[model samples]
Target: MLELILALRNALVQQGLELRAQEASDWQGEIPLPADIARFYRDIGPDNCNLATAGNSFFIPALARLWRMQAGYRWHGISGERLTDWHDDWLAVADQGGDPFIFETSSGKVLHDRHGGGSWQPAPLFDSLEQMIACLATFDAVWNSAGEDIFLDDYSVNPRHRERLIDALIPLLNSRSAAQSLADELGW
Candidate 1:
């Protein structure tokens, strides 16, 4: 089993790919999270195509960033966004029980827990598609279009950080017991 893991890892790396693990806080719970929910969390990242959970370990691609790490997450890529206000607004919306469509952060305040932490604001009065389109069109014409340069500039400073990012590769690949256990549990 371990040999198979090693072989799989080697095959992947030979193809210029890496098997990186993106940690999830949900997997830290005593009971395993629902597979559907876990997969949803894993999909928060652009590159995370598969999600598997064994015991407390949830395996996912390491390239996931804060934006793609959680469900219904949003961010504003403005250059001078501040954290204090962001948190305040998030809490405000959360207090209102509204789910916000977009999350915005600027240069001054770095969003903490980009993967899946910090506070959230619930979006009010825009839950419906019509409301969402209306809200977005307004925002697009007012804020997004005018501030496009600042947003682009922020990403340009560190473009890699904005996209799926994997900093390192696992030096040792495959855990045979783990593979066997997974197969056994799945009846594979």
Candidate 2:
């Protein structure tokens, strides 16, 4: 997996693209990691990603998202049949020049590069509780708007599978919330 990601990173570098890494506290600014990639997974949570690790390498989903400037909200586990399925889907999109966005059999898709270019430099979009609330509220609208169309449209609609992904993602999101809170209090 790491090798695959590296290969993609090499390809993107050849194209003169870059990733940014970011601090959790800087909600209104881009961190050091790829902002576009971070924004795609931003819904999943912030802790699962590290700019230092992602900045120099290419992750297929990240690459796909970067390539497409996709903000689609698809999430897949690292070790599972679902992961394999998602990877296959990602490759198909990447191969087709369909835009490097991540898609899942469960969730429909999240458009990352809706702006026509991936964000090599992304800014954090939150800083205070108000900011956080606003960000969450906006995302909530996005999340709810999709409703079952993305999550419950097919395999992801299965109780076990849907619950599994959400369950896994919730803790990560919570941890992100806590971490952000701490960072804010410390003036980070």
Candidate 3:
């Protein structure tokens, strides 16, 4: 978890993004983390929730809502001009087919759900959030090179932080494929 947070901090700064910190007190009982999710915050400090870049943001309830879309939109370019937030769940987390949202299901399995036609086409995307976060380490590389023309379905765990994130990963994983995919995706 710390590994991911550090990466986020560095990534935000690299992108010249602004940082906003949230405290547990700020939640004001409006949004709360269950035990499973609460543990993740302990490392980074529960009081500290939302983090953002200049044009992007990540808040707890975590990148997605329960069995629904997250932000429901995506930036068309690095300049982030064509922003659109959907009023419904089809775009849960992001534009289903137009932009892929690799998100956690209510059952804890990560799924890739997107839409361009009119409905969500959800497919198994990852086994665990930890595994997904690990794979996202390559996001900077992909974004730097490809921008909007890329598919980020592959996932892997960094050997250096494997054990470190496992505790957090185990609680949220519901399928073995997420683990298997890690090995298959990054040759772990």
Candidate 4:
């Protein structure tokens, strides 16, 4: 896991992508997590994310809400199992290539719907949060870090989203040194 996360960090740095986090104190009064989920956070916390960087959204504790909110709002289709309803037994944790990482509410299952997010064949790519994180970290290292053309070839959802994502990330690519410094400072 350490090796995988490091590879992702290195890839992002090579591409000038910046990761940020807030202070631990910022997480103090935030919405409480489920006992199980909170336990997971306690075990991994900010360290669980590949996107984490010093002062970036992923590394900071206070910004967990923002991350969770983004995850929660992703109401795309989920696994291919029994519970297929939009929001019934799942919570979104992350999204890549239009597919979402989801947590089963009733059963503590973590799943990644990589089949276009719900083409009716919702097979789970992973069964644990750690596995999901690893998948994302690997994807970041292998795909998103390469360049626009590569990202487009693989993760492009549509022309609009593609253009917007490229536009948003290109600036980070343009300013690599600053972002690299932050990652180095954060020991990411």
Candidate 3 lDDT at 13 equals: 46
RMSD of every candidate to native, in Å, equals: 20.1, 18.6, 11.0, 12.7
lDDT of 3 by residue, 38-90 (tens): 33333322121233211222332332232232333433345544345432222
lDDT of 2 at 157: 32
Give the alpha carbon lDDT tens digit for every residue of 1-188 in model 2: 44544543344344333333333333321223334334423332322221111012112333223323222312232332232212332211121123232333223332222223433211232222122322222223333344455344443333443333344334334555544442332112
Clashes per candidate (backbone, < 3 Å): 18, 30, 11, 8
Query: Of 1 and 4, which scores higher on TM-score?
Result: 4
Sort the candidates on TM-score, descending order. 4, 3, 2, 1
TM-score of each: 0.20, 0.20, 0.36, 0.41
Which digits, one per residue and each the tens of the lDDT, describe model 1 over residues 1-188? 44543554444344333334344663533333444323323432213322211112112223333333332333334543344434422211110112233322211111112223456432233222222222222222222223334234434312222111111111121344433332333212
Candidate 4 has its poorest 10 consecutive residues by lDDT at: 53-62
Better of 2 and 4 by TM-score: 4
> Alpha carbon lDDT of residue 13, candidate 1?
40
* Displacement of the residue 120 alpha carbon in candidate 3, Å: 1.8
Error of 2 at 59 (Å): 5.6
Candidate-wise lDDT, in order: 0.28, 0.30, 0.37, 0.42
